[model samples]
Target: MTPPSDPARIPGDAPDESELGRIAADLGLDIGAQHLAEYRLLIKQGLGGYSRLDELTSPPPTARHYDRDPGYLPGPDENPYHGWAWRCSIKGAPHGPLAGRRVAVKDNISVAGVPMLNGSPIMRGFIPHEDATVVTRLLNAGAEIVGKTAVPAFCADAAGLTGLEPQPSNPYDPTRLPGASSSGNAVVIVSGQADLAVGGDQGGSIRLPAAWSGCVGLKPTYGLVPYTGAFPLERTLDHVGPMAATVADCAAMLEVMAGADGLDPRQQLDLAIGSYTDMLEEDLRGLRVGVLREGFGIPGVSEPDVDAAVLAAAGTLARGGAEVMEVSVPLHSDGLSIWSAIVFQGATELVTRGDAIGANWNGHFDLDLVDFYRRAKPAHPAEFSPTVVFTVLFGTYLTEQCGHRYYVKAQNVARELGRQYAAALETVDVLLLPTAGMKATQRRTDGSIAQIVARALGNMHNTAPFDATGNPALSLPCGFSDGLPIGLMLVGRRYDDETVLRVGHAYEQLRGPLAVQPPKLADRR
Candidate 1:
């Protein structure tokens, strides 16, 4: 993702007083002309100090070769599905758990030599020279790296459409969104292009896409899976997990990707987790499943059929011997606002600050992002999509103008939300809800930036709170509404990913496979 060049700015070596004034003005600083020129010289000297950072000292490309990058566009287009397809075969163990599995990674995760677009034009040519921790784990488990998938710019949108890359479409209907941020990962899975994909979720990225695409997506317990290597968006909210065709497959992928990588600070070294796949049994006898009351009733926003379908799925689990009951967490309703404050401020901090604020277990930072933020000044901010432009502006304004007061308040409220969910989990093994209010939405061709923000924000109502509270959440296709699939989310106690997976697996078995298939690839078999 290469930042578009701005002709008005002075080149790195040649610092112009006018350019410094322009930067200071954009930052809302009020410095006098004499001091400003001195400041410009100081800034130029400081910039000179970073010459070493610009040099790519990484070792040679690790993959077999630099492969083809199919552009976004479905049918006769280099990339028909807007799914970035490349071939990087780094075969691992001959007889590992994931042997023979074809896997796609969301672009945010480093693939060592593969260009990580992060679904933005800003990072276009930046190729990481080292594999992300999950990539190494996947290869160790014998999964073949098929390629990278499209992501929303900075993983901010849940629209499944990249602002600058190919807009990923629902395989069932090209007019519909494919589920976002992890849009390309879901696209490849439903389109039968890959067996599984490793996706990162800060909000509902993995699950949202999985639901729309009719696949299983899991956001592993916070810290259960290492976050080393993937780009960060709100450190506390970040999660990396697997999206697969089935619950069992997803579990297997998680088994391989989970556990402490030593480099991921989020992982608790002594945390004990069981074999998630083994927990998948036909019977849910005696398990208590709480149907979250607030999960529905979004008034005009939530579709009745979608809620009914999820409720029915819970009832099916009840019939299989699980005790189902309704539970209320009042704060659950405020998820969107809380998530927005925390994420916007935190993301703004990382984007605007030269370095990450939190502990870096992986000993790595996105120097590329820092480079972009400092230099990006196209006349129109040319390469940024309306959605990204909106996010950056919103985040930066909130961070700078409000001085992060909302961010602090959001974190305080988030703790209460976590406590509320924890208290409910004490009585119930897992909480269930409609993964989202509606099924896959039709891609809007005439949307304003406001509408795009609204759509993306709407998709996260049910999923973002868990990110804030650091819970294990999973989204699986419970049923279909109209011709598109609907997702049912199961949230478990922090560090209790197995319970969530078990409940989801049991429900998956009881409901059976979804009848609907992505229309475009239904005949692929």
Candidate 2:
């Protein structure tokens, strides 16, 4: 007789009960069996539902997490005063202007009283004495944080949800992955759990998730948002940006978070250039948007569905009187190494400095290190996988040795490309392109080399360069394929966010009212 089929198993489903228990144990949280079942169901629906930011719009039980505090509670309550844990003390005061606005903070960032794991088990019980500079800015501006969101085991995993990590379930399909290291934050906002979410992008962390989840994410030029009191990723390239249901929402969050903080010694020390929030509604009647079609048409990329979405969005811009032109970026496929180098350097620093930060990694990481290598690393060092030591470690050595030369070359190329694209933008309001060549990869049940690497490549294609260029980019849900949402990326020249945002706002409005709700789990309902 054939073996009985397992009801609990979904091909490539991640974090089984045993695995979930390990994560819970590592964090010292009590997760009930019922909660796990609910979470699993939520995960399954998320794969099919929330990724497009269509799910979770309507109230549902799967939206609540048993292991965490109440997230869906309605209120205009202002949250967080900056260093990590939320200062939910302002419940009944005059509703902050952003009172009704809901937000989710990337877990790696500081939120007072909230335990920021930094995606590492090492910082398990950490509670910052103060808020991150960005957090304080949010509260003062009246944005209410719905809750702290989850991240990959470390913020350095550039593959986003490429498949190897235990961190977050891509809301689109439980069978597939959500791009990470900023997993939870993106899922929540796109699922409509919040109106805005702030994500830190060092190597495409914010943009990857935004692309996968079909929302708007911005990686402000480095130093736009103060990093004071937040855990470090590479001190050099670390950036804090906004993740929201719309580009306008992200702009509002940026208004609060952008600025140098006296407390953070590493702050860029540059004067804040007025408010990013002020630019959200700027006119975009005539602007130039560049379409870098190079590498976009490569195999495993520019899938038919995404290509159509890109063209469709570009058409939308043309209809609005903006000019669109095709351009090329010296960004080769091998550019992942450039991103990997910066990312690995930061992870290595955090892993080494765990003790200094009073972090919580001992139990989870020591075990995970062995499991990660076994599950994902290629037998040959050249294979791609986000969690493999070979990937991260090798990147460290490359960056240490040849990083400067490559960075300079990359920057020069980027400058030339920017100048070229900027010229196009002189007439186009927003550049249009498939935010990523492929849809989010299917979730990895096994975390093998093949699964992980493929997903990472797909995750980084459209969003990474903007990080290096320090240009403002916007993503809007253009359409869907096989039920997964695809995004239209709008790249604007440095500090031209207002122009890009107005374009995004106008697009969002043209797309019509986008109100999507999470799939209902009858048991929870």
Candidate 3:
């Protein structure tokens, strides 16, 4: 499908510091301005923020759903981003139950008339003939798809620095990148642009963005939500999940997103989940919850706030009558590497699916994965960001060369990790851990290599293994650092989402609701 069309854009090549500063100023993004300056200095000093850059780019949205974001009025004069987006303020409107409940969707998933822009420009203009199984479920549940979110070309890197869709800037500090492919969705959710959003997770696509943006993200038991109609990242690992302001909200959305669908081969995965929303009230008491003390974690960045918040949240569960124990997974290193291979495997698939050159997809991005989608498309080699294109090109070769072997190894790692995780459940019905080591970072126009490692790897540090084990997992904001949300992951045994949901909801209520709101458009406010 063709990526959506939009008018905003950054030049194809990486912009200089001065240029980045100018862009930030125009948009009133202070954080971005600072990062651009710091980035310039670092480049001169031979330093790098590859991870930061990677986080900035990512699962480039298939189309810029919000680039030309439509404005709305609740009382004759209001901006969409300003008031209606805030959950607490608008939670009880005409949309009542979900009245005014605005949501954004990742382009990888089907949304009927909406196009699935999986980050490659090749599919431009290709709109889905029907709503993805998940979307139809959402409509029946009362939520609305306000816009489609951007991604990093494919569901490849969660940092979503794919630089497509005029990448959504972090609201708190525009300099920092909103962890993505579901980048904009998470940002809008946190910044009060949307109440909840539909996001897909292959590695950390959903959770990382949620953690980074201080929202709640969930990847239900694999088959709980059908994969039919959603673009593939890795058939085995891809999930259509929910991103929301709170755990209860996610549970509500999950209620509708899950059901049997004959069209999906994976539909065989639909187990009998009685009531996802009902599962929310399950007690945390007598729940065996585990804490990850060693191995399998986001590396490089040292985020004190993230660590402190996650620990505090875990302690909160203990205070709530749950027995939280410490645990570790086997072959953590091997497991992570194997997952990395999986990322390359899926991304290469998305990139190679087409032969088109640069073409516009979302509101602000024209992603062409044939070469490199980040940055503006260069007329030739000189215009390309060497590292970005090289990563994709080399990744294509690597997936082709080592993917099968890695797949076997990853399967083993999945087995080993699952066994250990399952054993941990003996003492704790659920396991808790930091979703990512840090909050969101600055978004950049440069190819963000480290962001990939931080996001894809950091998130999977505690996640992926579950995908391997076919178990269920959930992430909720336990607390915040500097007001930005941090996630507390709840991992459960295979097909045990019910237990996880109960514990998650109990803990989420204790944490209360998020209190952030988007700014009223200048004069309107």
Candidate 4:
């Protein structure tokens, strides 16, 4: 086909023939000269609508309900554990459930006026214009927003080593890692910097850190908490939940955070929010607990002492009058592979290519963030952490070679995985496992790419699957191994978070308080 001698060009800049040819080459399309002109005319027609849309003003920004300051970066004395990303105090409603409690929000969640780095230099100067749904909820419930906690870059690394400055180390032992992504939240909660916290989890970010830091973390059922205003990795697997020093505190936070906010397509409109704190009073009497056999004794990954400690914790549930039995869901062992494929590909598309806010979702999009990242990332690609670089490279390779075939297959398999867990949940109210296969590992100053990647993901085997399946899983300090905390995980049926918390609270009562002391901080007074 031949084009008309002169094409009707849009007033603004449009792709010329040379640029079009390059795009065609990139897409592997063979367009002869004659056809190229015809395609160019068609492309110009498409740009006309975009040009019209560009002239319109954006919708009004969400109104800020509470006052807050542009928080400051704390010094060594103020942030001894390096757990804080930024510090400021935003008091909420004068009276409510959390009236006087202090809360640390993971840096990934937006707090309107505060700088949110999301634990990466690439996002350095970006300040959100609106609060994340969870943040707003926390404020409405009368909690004080004390500061932003650190996270691994893009919340990708599990070791907590690959992010912005002031990376958090374990409160129990500064030489070891606290855990990743939600690393600083755990440290702050355990060290008494904050009474509670909000943490995001795609693949065990909340639970792993809470486990290693001897605190309580809950990855509420996917979409139970609206993810609006937070930097998302993958839509399907994204979750934001509560982390605290005790199960009761976690429940109280969840009570405030859970509910549909009219934004965030991730949340279902009809989903009912529960009174999570009330469930804490319920004993574990007659509750059936399944100790997942596959969750322990990984040939190379699980440490013997860690396994023994978790098994002992499960026995404590038995002594609390719950019926305990061994149950095996062999597919549980395959969760990591499934989660890896989804996160690697999905995050690459959503975060790297889509600029942290992907397309095809009906939710409040933070255009400012999208614009900032689009400009910043290209200018400083070298500043991205190792995990970010690997995901981009590997995901791009998979997309170029196999397309979304692997991701699709993994999603399909993930549904089966969910079914397998559901079938197990049919008989038992909760499933028990080691939150992490081993205790906190020593921080390595240097290593090969393989070693670094392994250290980042090695502890996620048992916890990652539940994220993929969208089940409510809680991790609490079960015991101590080699002076580090060992986490016991309790996973319940979808939306049955109350039952999970009930069990965890009952077990906490029987086990007594964790013997580990908070890391002594330099006195600020």
Candidate 5:
């Protein structure tokens, strides 16, 4: 909590040689007794102002939405398939666009007075004192914050099966992964438990689950929705979006969710956001849909059925008066490598520095978060899932051996990739591809670390790039592959989320409603 460059204001008693020796050693300093005394004097003086940070307090909420005190309930196990962090019934405004809509908030996003597990055992008892921007917006719009849903540890898994609770099962088929990190968001919606869900996407968390769950998910342009209070992974890549059973519902949510809060530094002052639901139209007349020429060339990566379904979706749009064409942006193929260097390297820096880059953008942050990480991380490293452990290790290694130069290079190249996409967009309204090249992979009960990591990393090739390039991308059910839902990915230019949603709505009209319903919903209804 200490300010980065505050000068020492007062002196404290010098530490003893033994204490100094241990502290120095912990920092990789090997000071002998001879030099320890002088170092201790200097260190004690330098730390004199450290107590100033303790006087600071956590930020208070701007508004309270719960109609009644949110009492803690036993983790309800009504349906074992419905995995939630906690269950509570609460309502918001009596009349608004989302009134009467039941919604599930992802664990990583804060809800005032609620325990924010972030899908990690280490964060079990941590409670956020304020709501995330999205939560406040949703509450103001009259949506009930029904419960907190499950997520993979820190929302790190590519497959939805590893975290603090049982991974939310696929409503369609329990044997398959529902989707990555935002797994519960998709599952709860598909199961009829909630009408809409809030989800955050670093790579493909939002879309992956929507695809696998036979629903709609939108990862708006990187900063369109302020991430003022969400726990961050990589600041530049983090996105909070909506997931629902229909494109119109996703649009209605986005109408309230998007806009400049003047808090998230990621948001552009000149960015234009409008009523998204108003943009949804039944016809896509004269719109051009570009099929990325190189998106499906990877042999082992692209499954035949998945590819065919996306192409068929493109054809469906073509039949509905949209011009469909193939356009090549060769740099698209390099997305994974570039995304890896930036995300891993950036992630290492975020965790190691004990601070987030944009934490103060809103003039408030969960200072307890830093303290919690400080106390829990070293003490409970085992609490992280294998995928998160791998990411941390890989990131730490990259920072140590390669230094941050590679991260800088990756960021630089990412700008160029964005330009390439921008150029391609000038020729087409949106780019079409499979949200992921493959369909939902099988869920394993207890797999080896390698298998878990592989499962988490399997479906990121197509989606991760848009996260890096800051483009608006939406995934909606186009059809099913071997009975599992397949998603057609529609990507629009940065800040052009309305176009992407419009195209998706148009496509849905052409394809009609997808009939693949998860069996789990039958019993509940």
Candidate 6:
């Protein structure tokens, strides 16, 4: 990289005295007119370097490394469940671990020439010029790019509701919602549209959908997989990982996707990627499973059938030679509150103020996406969904009224939460819990604002906390309730994703296949 030119002794892009006074008033500063002139001159002097920056050329965009066509959006006939955002075939390497396997890339993830809506009309015509790191890695491992799965607008809702047409529905029951914002990733997997998928999770997006749709989804240990080109919600909570029809496929995909890509700041410098597939055959002979007691019996959230199913699944794990014991971490119940405080303020700072690409971080930044988002959001404000609108409003209010105190406090609390969970994990290999307190919820198009909000965020209690702690959490199909699939979640120590997968695989072997079948696409049509 070349250094920028030296600053010239010329005033450039500095605010005038009047503008500076207004800015100071907006920020609640008490600078007098006497000091305003001095501040203006000093500001102009400080801004002189930016003139050189403006004259210098920017670095070129990442070059496209593979051949691909601009994929077309699928019509109703082809997308009965509204799972696909765009469809195309981009073949990968001739042979590798995932050769011939079709994989779905979530729309929030960039795929070079593919049009990524991200379930929001605000970004309707934008096309990514570079593939996300996960996309490139998957293609390198011989997994053919099949399609981009749909998500809730800006991936803000977990109920699969979007501002655009054809909202995603549960594969088991069309009238119900498939969990989101990895809604379509789960849909395509259960419908057999793809063999594997890459799902982004901030707060239970991957695991919630997998639970409702009967697929295996793993939110790998935070930073275990790079998030270079994905649309992020909150940086601290953002995670990209694998989802598949089975644990083996999920593990195989993780083997390819996990590893620092040098472009993501979220990954630690000393991080070591595990061989997830190699540990799948490991038995559960001495694995101690702690059934998190607080993960069950929420006042309004937990359903009897869902809890019963998860407990039964634990019993099955015990039958397979694993020690199952109930453990309580009182702080576990407060995970969602801590997550909200951080996300609300953090997202507003990064997305609303920072143009979705915050500063003060050293890593690859997609300037093209940032430029587009900056231009598009202001022009098409109404295109934002209710969920997104609420997030912005709430987050902005929090920041404006409270400053960073709440966010700072929440982060401090989150560290303690991680310590408590780590202490509990010291005696056990993994913590077992229900992925969500309930099963798939019924789709409601007409409801009060409170009802809609409740539907979108109500089921995230069990899954959100792990995101805060950066624990490797996996959701796998465990049982069925009233013909709907129930999910059992396994959480392991940080960077211990392989053990989580191994335990999930062991449980899969112990329990026979789920009895309910995926609804036929033709029947829906």
Tens-place lDDT digits, model 2, residues 1-525: 111222122344545777777787876789987688677766766665335543334332111111223233122222111111222322212355466576678777765555555654344444443466677667666666556666655565654542223445556665656667666667666555566777887667777777776677877766667766555555555678888777677777776677776545445566546565565455445566667666367565678888887787767766776666776555444444555544454455443323223243221112222222223223323333356354456555755676556545655665555566566556655566766777777765366755555555446766766665566777667877876777677777666666667777777766665444334222110
| Per-residue accuracy of model 3 over 1-525 as CA lDDT, tens digit each | 223334234333455888767777876677655578676665555423443454475453323221222322133243332212211111112333454566667767665455555554544555554556666655545556665666665555656555344555665566666676676677667666567788887766777777776677887777677776576656567677888877778877777677767655555643686576776776677677778765324556447777777878878788888887777655544555666665554445543333322123221222322223222233223322222354467666765666556656666667776677777777778777777666766554444655444443444565665555656777777766675666777777776777877888898777666555434233232
| Predicted model with the maximum lDDT | 4
Q: What would the per-residue lDDT of candidate 4 be over residues 407-438, giving only the tens digit for each residue?
A: 99999999999999999999999999999998
Q: TM-score of each candidate?
A: 0.85, 0.69, 0.71, 0.96, 0.91, 0.95
Model 5: number of clashes?
0
TM-score for candidate 4, residues paired by index: 0.96
Cα shift from native, residue 289, model 5 (Å): 0.6
Query: Candidate 4: lDDT of 74?
Result: 87
Clashes of each: 10, 46, 56, 0, 0, 0
Model 4 stretches astray by more than 4 angstroms: 1-11, 520-525
Using TM-score, give the best candidate's number.
Answer: 4
Reference-based lDDT, residue 406, model 6: 94
lDDT accuracy of residue 187 in candidate 2: 68
C-alpha positional error of residue 492 in candidate 5 after TM-score superposition, expressed in Å: 0.4
lDDT of each: 0.78, 0.58, 0.60, 0.89, 0.82, 0.88
RMSD of each: 4.5, 16.9, 15.4, 4.9, 4.1, 4.1
**CA lDDT for candidate 6:** 0.88
Error of 2 at 23 (Å): 37
Score candidate 6 by TM-score against the native: 0.95
Ranking by lDDT: 4, 6, 5, 1, 3, 2
What is residue 252's positional error in candidate 3, in angstroms? 1.3
Is candidate 2 or 4 superior in lDDT? Answer: 4
Off by over 4 Å in 1: 1-80, 85-87, 355-362, 366-380, 519-525
